[model samples]
Target chain A: MTPSLEAVGLTKRFNSFTALDHLNLKVEGSKCVGFLGPNGAGKTTTLKMFTDLIFPSEGESFINGISVQQDRKRALAVCGDLIETPEIYPSLTPREALEMSGALRGMRPEEIRSRSAAVLEEVKMTEWTDQKVGRFSKGMKQRVNIAAALLSDPEVVILDEPSTGLDPRGMAEVRSIVRGLKKGHRLIFMSSHILSEVVDVCDDVALLDRGKLLFADTLANVSQRLGGNTRSVEAEFAAPVEDSVLANEIGSLPEVASWSRADARRVTLQVKGGPAEQARLLRQLASLSMGLISFRESRSALEEVYLREISVGDA
Target chain B: MSADVAPARAGSLPIADGAIGTVPGTIAQAITLSRYQLRDYLRSRRFVLMIAIVVAVGTILTTLVAYYRPVGLIDNANNLYGSLWGGGAAFLILFAGIIFGGDAIAGEFQNKTGYFLMGLPLRRVTVYAGKYLAVLVASVVSILLFLAIVVGNAVFYLGVGAVGDLGQLFESFALALLYLLALMGFVFLFSSMFKTSLYAVLVVAVLFLFGFSIIQSVVLALTGTEPWFLLSYVNQIIAYPLTGVPEHVARATIGRATITNYAPTYFEGIAVMLGYFFLTTIGGLLLFEREEFT
Candidate 1:
């Protein structure tokens, strides 16, 4: 589990404004880690620093344990970075652009030819390989942009809000691509502002606020630790039940603070106690004439922890 | 670098097929990037426009020289050197620099192309050197093509024997290229300084075409001093080969004031162009290196 990407005391300042403070983070192994933050939280700045697009005011970053500032050529050689909204030359065809990019990475002739096809297909842009990128839509351009990053088959793929400005369909397509990349032995680090997007695609979340790492751990850990005893649970029924019966059953549970029948077969309840009381309620509901099919947390617990941490940082 | 990134297994990457070359040195990367960038420039619309402009001007100059055959212009060498390099070549060099180098650096930042390029393992100095070489090749090719057409016509009208002193044409050509490098260096400097492509192109075009001459004129008019420091003074050497250069010239009685026009010698002209080349080229690269893609 050697670290794929590491930042040590990294900082960036612009005149009086501090874009990123002294920050340290190390992501190891092959997995998708979500770099989450509010707008102006220095996600893009961190990505830029990793790629050596700008020098850090203090400290440094490393790729595969090679200091980026010391040996940038070797450090980033195995990385594919898509920072902000990077555009390929409008005049170049996708194939031509990929070939150029491959050559720049020192790939041989046959390697460029072969990888040009492979990356174009990976981004689902094989059909439009010969067409000029100038005519491409924003989503198509973004796909090609990501495709360029994949040309080198980098061990660490750094995407800075890849879904930004893409339509819903484009977002879904990019998400699918990210999901597909997980099977490979590559560490994908993507930054996004959307909470649900991170929850859906990332195995780990590193939340930042005001240029500080608020928390960095598994989504499950964050949700479990922050999900308090008083939690909302959604219950689904096998068949429709009358409103009177649902109310009588709701009144029978002492732990239930509030209850509502969302539909003929579903009920949402705010249980006051922890998991034990919630489990007792489920058992009690199963014993009743009301047939229960499933029970689950009503909302993403990660959202709660995120809000709490962000508020604390703000204070 | 962390155990060679998992031993570079063949086709382990979805994008790459079997194997790839080891990461190259800075010079190697720069050369590779330059080759592609040069190809892109050659295929660009600006390159086509530059060719057309050079062709049109060369045709007009040749046609006029063949039909009118200026009275004092004794031979093909005299006519070719005087009108072609003196007029057509000077403007071509300026236009070539403007057409290619104006948006060279600014376009990367303005278009956000640098976001991806700078993300690569390559250094900023590599990117800068690659682009500089690309523009240089494009400009030199265009200028030489224009001169070729003029030379071809020289053979047609005045015969090959009449154009004996062709060596002077080459010397003039060399001088023109030196001026082009200097002008393009300035263009690149402006390109790196500004964020907008239009501003870079406009500023360069204005200064080269009319701004330099106007400034030089104003300085001389106000101070009664020769503007030897101006690069435009040295640019005159591009055409000076065709016409005999006097040691110095003085115009009398500009409303009871006499003014001197100092002519730069061949060595002096080269020194001036080299100064611009070094000063602006270094400045441009420094600006490009320090610039942030934010």
Candidate 2:
């Protein structure tokens, strides 16, 4: 069965406050879909409902067409999840923790042992297999948590802010692990507020704010659909140019919507139109003999869409 | 650098083609969870602390019997067992229930470990039963340790041949086990009621240690009625088998008031324990099932 996760009209309310409101989304096939939302935007709440950690107040969540509310065990049989920052028993070792996870899923002892080793190595925690989790750093424990989620190798994997509390290197390592997960033909539904991480790992992005979904589409399509006809790029000059000289050169270009000096030698430009317009503006700037050194996108296309949609959502 | 990024081989463990291994039934899942949970308990500091408490209580009883050599205690096996085992078994059971079960359910939520366990294919019933089973096993180990010390003292004082009423001693032990069950059920209910381990442990400790006894006394004195509904009242049966059943009620006059004392009969005691075991255990599971991991 092609792995799929669907949330139809899902709503969750804690007394007067709605944590998730009428969320409707369906993700299918083997790809990474980022559940992107700011903090307190109900990203975690939605994932909890999918994994049956919390029940939906209205509508339903389904995994591979099986209703999570009706038959949670069977529906989740093909699913693996790491929701919130789940702590393993401090007394347990990584291997022992993974073994328990496998046993709970009904894997035979031999299978559990073999898969436990494989997953530990996968998360690069083989050296810490027998070490007590109490002795591990936050990053190490998070890796073990991820390894437990992958122990069964289910068709669908859900991760909730897997790098929420990690250092820069730790965050990079988690992103690398997530990128590798996408290669195994599994549908990865990951929630995060980190836009760069999503752009680096997710094939599709779903923006949510204040319990409402603002947009959902592929990364490329999000920029095209919502980014309008303008794109931002940073340009570098070989020498420091005066602000007026730079403005006159950029202002002469019909495609240049706006410009700002980032530094003595760098300027940011907002160009009208798509890639053609951007290329034309780049050429026009180069012909001006203003010592153009480099030109590149200042922010990711998804980041732009994310900021715009989130600000619009705030409104 | 962004475009050059490729999928690394970090989490690409071999994926199973379709569904992973067949998910176990609830019973199997509960057994697996209980086995691991028991291992954790065995390695925990709390387990060591419980052992220490049992040994301390046993040593104090042994030293008192040896140094003083009270005629009331060493004169006969029944008196020795009754004074030591019967008099002290309920307290040991109460301590065991508090130590093993006070934070069993609440810790899962407080520490966020439930987030890891609840995401699996296991049902909430399985998790509840598994933790309860682990707590029961740990409590039983502590109870048995206390009993061993009691038996050791009995043989030293009365001799093996003179140790009286082995049958009655076993009956008391059985009743102690029932009381343990009922007390643990009550403890787990409180644990399930709170999301913080400190609250659960504090509430269970307070109620068992002083709250119920005070309430039982107040109820008996104020109404001149039976405190049969109180677990502390029913627990007297644990010792009654060895001490012989006490009177159902006794009356005394104090100032202008008639004060009443009551003892639960074997049948009433067993019934109340069974009622607590069923009602509180089931109630705890229902609460756990409905609680959201918010």
Candidate 3:
């Protein structure tokens, strides 16, 4: 099957600012690929180029093998996009907005109505279908925007920060809906800042920093590279304590490789792990009246890989 | 989990517009986009408010004119048509054109929603054409509403003996449509040129209210050129059907008067305005086709 989206040597610039530099990426059909990056790291810019919101300054992109620059209309016809904030007509209800979108894509009226209702229901926005989006809360509007993107049953759906403002419940709803879409269209979502959402929904990830792709691979591979040496154990003190005392205790633990104060009240430990040593470390923290916030004995998460790659630049 | 496991599913690659199936012509794509725009514009509260205001203003102006300068029964049809078409209809379309067309593309840029919209399954021409047609239709709707009010007022004034001149009335209305199209063309051009809606509206307002007039006066005064050379003069070609030909002050007779030569005939004047429309529109599109989102 044709790859749903592909970009080879895609470069875009704004005067002196290089938003995306020689970025190469490919997303297979019927999969979810998370576009991971930090702000000013070209995540939104890349999405813009793919969606043809802005043409690339240097290289080219193709959707289903159609050049984005050479044939914008056909490319856009099958691709549904929600970039940045979903700034739709304030006076339009979710239903009206979707219906309008469906008509633009050449869907008939009855098809628009049924499809719109189904997408809204899938996003759990049926209750707010008739209410004007102007009054919708941020999470509510995001869901409505997602519904609009899905209205035409696009073969490729690209979302930039799709879950930015969603509450936990709303975010989960979006995640599951995106996951369910994995069976058909290729889904390319930019979740640069929201690491957890990317982890939960995306099967693969492309880590970007400073307008360059640092790593583009399966999430599992990226995590394993960083996760093998990392552990996230949070300890909260019952009372304020000196760094020296806690640091000494943490330092003496043979398996502990690094420790960092997450906040004034909590210290997160990174330790080598085995069942016996992991239990001992928990006992030591328990005896000190250090309330355990979280304890995980697992591999590195997307967050760790992201921080590790980015921190190397900072160092 | 196997560390080397590639993602079992690969999302698809980026594709161009109209490639999934077939790319339609620019006009076809534009028309489809315009259909949605028309629906949205009709439902917009601002659009509704604009119609109401135009109609109310037309009614008030027509009533005041009838009461103050009551024409004898002999020329009642001509007199009423003149008052409404010249004064009420002209003014309402001016305002309507500004409201509907002055911010067409600029609004898309300002809201950043263009990011999603410009990426659609059509070309830039389709996007632009769609928006322009929608604005044109919406402006026409407002103008039509004002026309209705004027016609209604004429019926009330003439009462039982009143004979409304349907022929002259329609002629005036057709001319109004041409005037609106020409004027709105300029406004849409400006809308696409600027990124901010307010700036687009302001520039259009100035051109309509002052810029064109000022240019006409200066060109006529200094260069001894016809005022028709100015955009505002061209507009009068359409505006003068309601009011009889405006008397031109001879430039030689008055040292300070801006009038230079006689205004062009209606066709010549329209051609000139059409020239301005084509220039500005092409210019705006060229600029927009290359502009960055930031």
Best by TM-score: 2
Cα TM-score of candidate 1: 0.88
Segments in model 1 whose C-alpha atoms lie over 4 Å from true places: A1-3, A229-248, A251-298, B1-20, B162-164, B249-256
Give the Cα-based TM-score of candidate 3 against the true structure: 0.85
Q: What is the TM-score of each candidate against the true structure?
A: 0.88, 0.93, 0.85
Greater-TM-score candidate between 2 and 3: 2
lDDT of 2 at A172: 92
Error in Å for residue B236 of model 1: 1.1
lDDT over C-alpha atoms for residue A116 of model 1: 83
In order, the Cα lDDT scores of the candidates are: 0.81, 0.86, 0.72
- Order of quality (lDDT): 2, 1, 3
CA-RMSD of model 1? 5.2
In candidate 2, what are the lDDT values of residues A139-232, reduced to their tens digit? 8888899898888878999999999667898789889888888888789999998888999999998888999888788887877864456888
lDDT of 1 by residue, A1-315 (tens): 243777778899998889888777878787899998989998989999989888899877877777777777777778888988888777778888888788888888898888888878877889999998878988888888988888877788899999877888778878888888787788888999888788888888888788877778887677566534567789898999778776776655887888888888888888876678988988888888577899887866677677778887888
Regions more than 4 Å wrong, model 3: A227-269, A273-294, A297-299, B1-29, B72-74, B157-164, B239-261
By TM-score rank, best first, the candidates go 2, 1, 3
Name the fnat for model 1: 0.42
